[model samples]
Every structure is written in structure tokens, then in C-alpha cells.
Target: MYAIVEIAGQQFKVAKDQRVFVNRMEGKEGDSISFDKVLLTGDGDNITVGAPAIDGALVGAKINRHLKGNKVIVFKKKRRKGYRVKNGHRQALTEILIGDITIDGKKKSDSKKSEPKKEDKKAAPKAAPKKEESKKAAPKKSAKADDLKKIEGAGPKAAEALVNAGVDTFAKLSKKSSEEIKEILTNESSSLAHLDPETWPKQAKLAADGKWDELKQLQDDLNGGKA
Candidate 1:
């Protein structure tokens, strides 16, 4: 279970067994602090959002440490006017561990559920081995291929462009519009421009298909040409 809690005028996303650092509060090690401002609460799939804050919701946390942040050097100077000042500062911080998050002042224990016995754990069967399947067996391989090609340095928009341009595979990219390639390469920053475009396409295709040795050969070829 997790919650968005407000403490010391700051909101933090916290979960059980997680540690968070915030501006130092009035507490020593092992001191418990209850965050009354719970903006939201979530238990895996289900989430409860508050209208400002959930009524009677409280998140309990344990103070782990009181420390200081990394030292930052602040300097100020006026040229040739004998005005020079420098100072170092480290912000105080408090580390807290989220103990438990309670919503509506009630625990999340289901009345229908019962604890499993030790024998029940031992009697459980082992999981079956997962089969290694190739991209040929998956429907999303083509979409993934398109993503792999155009996602070199481009964000979501450029990825959409390559997907729309019918260049679904790296093999297709090697032969697609150079204008589109340049647009993708120049508009965004990618190493595809520095290395041989031919070798890059082949390498990407081999990697997608899990041809390790062929990929190595292409890398060697590119390096050799550079040498």
C-alpha cells in the first residue's frame, strides 16, 4: 500500500518499506511522525483520491536520520572593485521510513481472507519454465521494430513519424526517404549520422532478431572502416 502524504508543507509519494528525505523537522532518530494530510491512497489497482485531503486519513512514518545535503559553494564578486565573497552551504534534511498508511482510520484486512499454513506453502508446485519465443511469434514485433529505428534520439513525436512513414523495420529504414532520415537525424540528436548508415540499419536488424555474431561482425566492420 502507498499514499501521497504532506509533511512540513511538502507532499511526498510514500509506500511501505520505502525511505524518503525531506527538509529537517523537529525530531531525532526513531521518532514517529504522523502525516495527517493524505492527498491520495492506493492499494495496487485501486486508488482513492481526496478532495484536498482524505477525511481521517493518516500516514505513519519513523524518522531514520537527521543529516545535511551536499555542500554547495556560493560565490559573488565585482571585477576590480575589491568586492569578493564566497560561502558554502548544506541544507538540513530528515530521512523518514514509511511504516504504514491508514485510510479512513481502518486497516485493510479482509474479513474473508485467512493466513496460509506452512504446509500450504510447501505443497505449492514449482513454476513451469518460460518458453523463449522469437519476435516472429509476437504481434508487436513490427511496432517495436519501428520504435527501435526512430527512437534513437527522437521523443514521442518523431517515433510517431516513422510509424506513419511505413518504415516499421530497421531493414525498411535503410531504404526509406533520406529526407525523412535527415529530418529524424538533424531535428533530434542521434549517433546514426556519425557511423555508416548502412551498417547501423543492419546492426539494428540483427539485434532485433537476436543475431549476436552478425551484430558483432557489423560492429567490427564499422570500427575497421573508421580505423
Candidate 2:
């Protein structure tokens, strides 16, 4: 059986045990969630679709995880004017497994019962160390790289070069001079010159100075302004 359900104000077609990811949602892994905005449902011979959303139909799912999507590079440039722009995006996403789809409030079973096996505690392996590994303290650790990738115009290569040049953190990036960063980029890869001239340096500077809120706000403004 299949059903179309709405989550986070968006609609999806789903089936039992099917996993899907949508816009980031406020739930932790292993949490149960329900959707009342079931738009359509069907089982072999019967079909039910809503004028907008089906009444009395509920879809239940379990949150599998909340994660970010793959990095996407956005590069913009105009010929010969030294006008260039670059950005990157890693969209937040939530993964869910559709469990049950109900029609007229009657739920369909998602699995078949299986016999339980007896536990063999004696065969269990011994537990290992739980403490985390520690590294030498890095006093120069700059916050500049906290989320340089979040700027929406950088890539793994840029990030690597930045880190290699002591711009490993967001705080460091924001504090460094634009000329310095540009010089580093030029020395590392002249290709970076294609980035948005007006905003990249400004954003990097803002991030270095610990003006994170402003940094995000500026990114949003740039996006909204179609920069």
C-alpha cells in the first residue's frame, strides 16, 4: 500500500518501511512522528485521495536521523571585469522511515511477527575503551573555520588551502585581511579569483571577527538579493 503524506508543509509519496529525507525537522533519531495531512492512499482495489488532504487518514513514521546533504558549489562570474562570486551549501535534512499508513483511521501492519531467540550473554565480546582520543592543544585554533564551508561559495579545495594557510577556523578566516586571503588563494589557485568580488572577502572578514550572527545575516541577504 502507498500513501501521500505531508511533512514540514511538504508532500511525499510513501510506503511502509521506505526511508526518505526531507527538509530538516525538529526531532531526534528513533522518535515516532505522525502526519495528518494524508493526501492520498491506496491498496490494490481501493483508492482514496483528498480534495486537499484526506480526512481521518494518518501516517506514522520514525525519525532515522537528522543530517546535512552533500556540499553544493555555487559559482558566479562575469567575463573580464574581475567580477566573480562563489558559494557553497550543505542543506540540513531529516531521514524518516514510513511505518504505517491508515485509511479511515485503520492502520496497516508494517511487519510480520517472528519468533524470538534466546539470549547468549556468554558469547558476547568484551567491552572496549570508551574514552575519546585527545590531541595536543592548539592554542592558535581560530573560530574562523567553525563553518567556513557554510559560506556557500567554497569547496573542499578552498577549505583545504584555507586551513593550510592558518585559516583553519571561521574565526581565523574572519580576522584575516581580504588581500591576504586573496593572495593566499592566488598563490594556491588562481581559479579562486572567479569568486564574487564584493562579498566573499567581506563575509570572510565578518566571520573572523566573531560576528557570526551578522555573517549568517549577510549570507541570507546575499542569497535574497540574488548575489
Best by lDDT: 2
lDDT of 1 by residue, 1-227 (tens): 88998765468888998999887677679999888789999998999888789877888889999899999886666568896777787877889999888885433333222333343457553321122244345656554564543223333434444556555566676564445565654444332233223344455566567676876665543432221
Cα deviation of 200, candidate 1, in Å: 59
lDDT of each: 0.63, 0.69
TM-score of each: 0.43, 0.47
lDDT of 2 by residue, 1-227 (tens): 99988776467889999999977776779999989989899898888878678767889999999899999997776678897788797877889999988775433321211211112234422321111112223333442236656655665556666777777766566566657766776676554544443455677677667687987877764642235
Instruction: Rate residue 80 of model 2 by lDDT.
Output: 82
Off by over 4 Å in 2: 105-225
RMSD of each: 17.2, 15.7
- Highest-scoring model, TM-score: 2
lDDT of the structure predicted as candidate 1: 0.63
